[model samples]
Target: MKKRINNHQRSTIKKVMNYIRRYWGYLGMSIVLAAVTVALTLYLPVLTGRAVDLILEKGVVDFAGILAILKKMAVIILLTAAAQWIMNACNNKITYNIIRDIRKEAFEKIERLPLKYIDGHSCGEIVSRVIADVDQFADGLLMGFTQFFTGIVTILGTLIFMLTISVKITVAVVVITPVSLLVASFIAKKTFSMFKLQSETRGEQTAFIEEMIGNQKVVQAFSHEDEALEKFDEINGRLQKCSLRAIFFSSITNPATRFVNSLVYAVVGVVGAFTAIAGGISVGQLSALLSYANQYTKPFNEISGVVTELQNALACAARVFELMEEPSEVPDAPDAVNLEEADGHVALEHVSFSYVPEQKLIEDFNLSVKPGQRVAIVGPTGCGKTTLINLLMRFYDTNSGTIRVSGVPVNDMTRKSLRNNYGMVLQETWLRSGTIRDNIVMGKPDATDEEVIAAAKASHAHSFIKRLPHGYDTVMAEDGGNLSQGQKQLLCITRVMLCLPPMLILDEATSSIDTRTEIKIQEAFAKMMKGRTSFIVAHRLSTIQEADIILVMKDGHIIEQGRHEELLAKKGFYANLYESQFVNTSSQA
Candidate 1:
């Protein structure tokens, strides 16, 4: 376990260095400034020593010499302060730039991931990595950038200046410093795993919060308030424990390092006093040695603290890197062609797939959809209806066999190009925080105002949209929260109407709309799908009564198929389903 953790820390450090390497120019400038700052600042002790010697002369006091030394001290102080300021500016720039690049790469990797990966993980977990974890990492990295470089230069500069004054004292200081380092290193090693657990638990907690927030209505509908609160308390208590444990381990580093620093200071003072008494060095020289001793040891305290914080940085960075390194969706085939203006002849040849190996969902699924064909698929929930849409859109590749569009294998076409050939509206509605016109033009960004209004009218969305304060120009709240469910569905349908791709997939497209509005939208959809190959997945048998072919699916296969009248005449599984739904509706009325 220890070996694995050490390796992980080493790997995180290596990857972090690679990211910083991209800004070598800024980093190099920061280092040079830090060196200059330290070098000039190191000479201050020497100036103080000279001033002390001049003022303590047995003869008449040489005010002239003291004044000159003071002037030099002022000049060096100004230069050192100036260099330190510029160095901090450079550090800030480098830290923020690296942070931006990391977030950009993480988000881009997420976009390139397969649907299976997203389906297998919680949205809150991914969001936490991108947001909370990145923020935590940024704090640690910025702290390092500001302190680590200057701390190293200070220690080295102070050591060299002290060596020039007295090696005997320098050796004592150096030897005692390792004790502090040993203490800090030991504590730092223990914090990494604790902090890692804290980060993971925080992500899980975020996932739960997001899940509950998104489904609060459902939770209330089911009277699950107490259960949710209990679950949340459990997660919150775990996070509190993790946080306390990590903080406890890291918090002791400062005092431990300070104690060692104080020991080093005491040794330097006692040794320098003895040396001065023996006439090995003058009083002024001894003063400079004491100052050097303080300077040299102070950084050990700071650097050790930085190291503790650095452990936290590495823990957060490992999570971010893990996300970036997830295998991206299979790259486009080397010879993949663009699917342009497809004739919409889709065929599935023995396609097999499952969300998990142990529980296969769709196996040996076969279908043939002709150009301009209107096929309606109806099935019980959890029967792999949406899974078929996922394959058709190439959101997930088939486990075996093939799915082809226009006689061309889907795998042989660039995913973007393949997806462009179809327009889809699912049961769920998604709208960005944008104006009504903006959402309508998502699939076809260059659509004109007149065309957008025409599509809205056809989708039965125009009348309500016009009633809004700004008509089509009105901005929507997040996810169109400002709109009614029926209104949101109407807007989504407007998107498909505006694009009118050669092929269409409507999965419970009008489920949220009023029955009266649904009838009008169905009329509009009928006109839109007139010459386009269309696949409608619906539970409303009445809506699909006019479909050219109605497929009854059970357990991932089409058990029965025919026109509505033909299926009813046969009195098979489809007939029984239709009869039951009709009976339920009549009884409810």
Candidate 2:
């Protein structure tokens, strides 16, 4: 089992450290340059002491020498400042590259994931994992590594200079350092836990918002406004509480560091007073030591602040890693073979399947469709019509059966190559926030304008599309909100037709359309399915009557399988279903 460091601070720190290793050259150079800059800064205050002591005691100050010393120091300061800038730029460049790579990999992984994985996670959560989590790593790198490296280097250099000036004062400063660190470490540990809670709460809040917004129509239809608001408020309240606690712990760091430094300063002041009175230390050296002490403690305080932030960042990194480590649903098997041009044949032999364990939906199912044959599945709700299609597409593997396409087991074929042989129009149409042209071309990215228009015409969508404000260029909002449900479904049909795959799967394709649109759509569909192996899941029996083979399904079994006339003559399930519709029509009349 992998140990999960859920704390943002800890996860951020670890990721930053990992990045240092990833870009070791940049990290090493940055550290070295920063150390030199800090060493120069500490050197200046000591130089000031020497110049002051000489001017006070000599009675005859060398004016030319003083001018030369000042000029040399100025040049050194400028050079060191430039070096520090270069080091920081390098760190930023490396960090940006690393973040870009992470984002790309996460997105690529998502593309290859199985449909079950998509079904299990919300769109918002998946988006957050890729976008927000990678951003956390970038921010963490800046806070945990670059700033931290410079602060530590400067603090160490300042301490060394102080020790050379006066061992007693250096020891006094060092004594307070451990106590400050201990306090900071304790606070950081607590902050880490709080940050983890904060991140989890945020994820929940995002999930809630996405769910409510995505089902806004359903919520309104069911009059669930109060219920939705109450649920959102609960998540928001939890997020606020966790965020406050994390921030509170972070806030204590600076004060705690400053308080310890203040005590150290008081002790140093008493020691300086006694030393100056006894003539054991000069005013110039005392002044320089005081300045160096401030330099040393300043970075120490900064380190404490950085540690707090690092803890939070680490917590975020841990969450991101969890996403990265999720077992991929479409992991490729070794030596997987690519599927070439398929012959449009499909077979499911003794197949058994379940969406989740212990909830078996299909058992010992057998299906075979020859080249260019059309099969229609008619069933009541939850009779596994969609599940059959899922198995054919290899979205979920059969537990105890072999599914083959063109005589090759689906599992043996590369996922991309296998999917290329088939085109699908889902029960629920999904449209991107783009023009009608864009959505149509999604099925075939390289499709020409004429090709897209032809596909739309074939799906009976062109006439309606032409009436839009800008026709093919008319942009749609999220999920094509500007279009009616039937229009959306027709657009999906256009998309699939554009692909021109050898096999087609239509899951409740005409369910959303009105009678007039359905007639037009059915005409288009009939033309589209000509000489193609196709599976249609239909609620309306009339649509399947002309199918080459009709399978009436119930409880994951084919209760009736035959041509329209054959099944009607038997006076079984199909006949009873046909009679029930007639009885409803008579009652309504």
Candidate 3:
């Protein structure tokens, strides 16, 4: 029984309590307003009945007294309304702030999360957690508790007033409330699971849409639009079914509540007529009792509706809190320390790692680079070259080895402190839609015009940039579509150079450029690498000639390591790779 209760009180109630505890002042105000509103509403009919009784008995009602009573009742209602509105407005403001906080925190948490966590969850799934689930919960939080309390308080106050007026009529009306409540509860319980199922299905559909939009280029390239559409339709069909089920169950509440309310209304009319005939109740009393009975029944119906809605809201809240309670992707260790000085001497010692548990991608990987040494790493496809760079950058923690900078383990360093110390140029250059200067100065926002120009010149990108329609201020189109592949790469290189970090990693940075641009970029690269501890993941052998050391990787291990000239003479893996390249070049010639 305890376990069952705990299950019912999971994420939703926990999350609701957190919000309620934080904004209890606003909630308290709203509740007080609600009580006043109900009290005023309950007394209005009694005052109206008194006015009627006075008029009938005296043949002339006390005008001042009746006006005073009406005026007092109106004042109560207006004050109650104004207070409730103010409290609800305050509640809305708090809810907006809470939603913003949740979304912002969720995004920040997602950023710190390990690559495995991101890769395991689809973009749609994570988006659903952040967007849809949070939205539903936030909506529920804003109105669910306030409206529910109002309904309950109103129902109870109405019942008390009815019982005071006459026991028989009160009994008749009260009997229907529980029967309505039980039926509504049964329907709500039955429908709660369906709401959850519908939400999950919607999330799946959302994820698919996100995936498709993010990879629209791939979809068009593969001509899989029809297949994608078919799959989407299939998921949408399932979503429709879940939606229908939820709606079907929810529909039962309103009609059932109304049916029970109609029965109470009939009973009240019959009992009230007999009471008036026997002198047990006045005509005014009977009319007042009838009005109160209607008022009471209205709340019962509203309460029933609110109960079902609360169940659905709870389901959404549960999903949202479940995500919030998930374990952090890369939580800080107990002994973590902030990095102070970043001299950029990156070292990897016995660094074994793998994305998949079954396959060890880097078994006992060991490497050391002196400060300001330019090293090149070359390998066949899937040979852990990118993995090694990823490990060096501390994007993924090594499975069994230690990666350090200046004798300090990277795991101990704060991510912000560590990442801010280095610059990178990736193979696929991503340029946000912004001016050329905007993209260039992104690396160092405080950079002056002269500094931006100097960095661009050092990257060999200044000449082409100057020729654009708007020169340095030319707006780059979406994804840098306005620029050539080589131009985009040059722009990215310029951005990296602007940072002027002591450490740099160029991962297949020049591979997309033409031979002419590659030569030009190599010159700029040579200039940038001087006195910087740089790691170059190169495909072309010509690029590695000037490196102080070359590491040839195969599978997941380093098979050859030496200076460029020294490796050519060994007739090993590096020698074979060089000879194979030579043969391919000769055959092309």
Q: Candidate 2: misplaced stretches above 4 Å?
A: 1-16, 54-73, 333-335
- Candidate 1 lDDT over residue span 1-589, tens digit each: 9999999999999999999999999999999998998899889989999878886647767899989998999999999889989998998898889999999999999999888889999999999999999888988998898889989999999988988888888888878777887898899899999999999999999999999998999999999999999999999999999999999989899889888888888898899999999999988998898888788877888888888788888899999999999999999999999988899899999999988889888888889989999999998888888888899999999999999999999999999998899999999999999999999999999999999999999998999999999999999998998999889999999999998899999999999998888889889999999999999999988889999888888887888888999999999998889988998789999
TM-score of 2: 0.92
Q: Using TM-score, rank the candidates from best to worst.
A: 1, 2, 3
CA shift of 207, model 2, Å? 1.6
Q: Which stretches of candidate 1 lie over 4 Å from their true place?
A: 57-60, 587-589
lDDT tens digits, residues 273-358, model 3?
A: 99889988888788888888788778767777776676666777666666666677576577777776577687888888999999
Winner by TM-score between candidate 3 and candidate 2 = 2
The true-versus-predicted C-alpha distance at residue 305 of model 2, in Å, is: 1.3
Q: Whose TM-score is greatest here? A: 1
- Kindly give the stretch of ten consecutive residues in candidate 1 with the minimal lDDT sum: 53-62
Give a tens-digit lDDT track for model 2, residues 1-589.
Answer: 0225334344555655675578888877888888887878888887777766767555688677678778878988898889878888988978887777767767777776767778988877777666666676578667655678778887778778777777887787787779888988788777877877787777777777888888999999999999999998988888899999999989998998899878777777788768878887888788887777677777768888888776666676677767666677856578887887789999889999888878878999998999988899987889999889888887888888899899988888887788888889888899999999999998688999899988988888999999999999999999999999989999999999899899988888888888988898888788878989999888778888888999999988999998989999999998888777776778899
Number of clashing pairs per prediction, in order = 0, 16, 1
lDDT for residue 440 in candidate 2, whole number 0-100: 91
Q: Judged by lDDT against the true structure, how good is candidate 3?
A: 0.82
Clashes of 1: 0
lDDT computed for candidate 2: 0.82
Give the TM-score of each candidate: 0.98, 0.92, 0.89
